[model samples]
Target: MDKAARKAILRELREQERARWWATLGLTSAQLDALHEHILANLIDCCSGELELSEQWANQVGVDWSRLEQALMELGGYCDCEVEANVCPD
Candidate 1:
């Protein structure tokens, strides 16, 4: 209803959404990195930040694409929804 109340609601929603991202999956960055590296290692010689890893390789290496996608989406949500806008214009 008021400014303070709206801010409090936003903060609470942000926290809950963030928790679902990192905590619900129960995965650390290191673990996710390992999965990526494993896929990259077997499917790619060197990523160089430009490699299209195959789905077969992903299946073979057991990469958790859904979780990674979810994490990335959540990070985007944090940046877009929680961060102040236009602090530094491009």
Candidate 2:
């Protein structure tokens, strides 16, 4: 695809992400704070090579892990092994 097309696609994706972030903002303060802590703990565990602990944290949070992971990524938290590379492989 051409540069303009690529740019348009990226912009659309970013807009969708922004919408998702806004949805998270609609959550109650308590819920939001809990989620932030859960995400933070998960990220820390993952970075420390504690995959099992990360999974446990997700389970304790009682949220869909996939959705929580996506939210964490959008919020600028890194968990993947490639975090130092600044690249998160899906």
CA lDDT of every candidate: 0.46, 0.53
lDDT of 1 by residue, 45-87 (tens): 3332222332333355565656544554455422211111212
Model 1 worst lDDT run, 10 consecutive residues: 77-86
Clash count, predicted structure 2: 0
Candidate 1 whole-model C-alpha lDDT, 0 to 1: 0.46
Residue 75 of model 1, lDDT score = 52
- Quick one: best lDDT, which candidate? 2
Question: Using alpha carbons, what is the TM-score of model 1?
Answer: 0.34
Per-residue alpha-carbon lDDT of candidate 2 for residues 1-90, written as tens digits (9 for 90 to 100): 999999999999999876776575344446556644654545542355323433455577575667655655566544543322232233
Q: List candidate 2 stretches off by more than 4 Å.
A: 1-27, 36-55, 80-90
What TM-score goes with each of the models? 0.34, 0.37
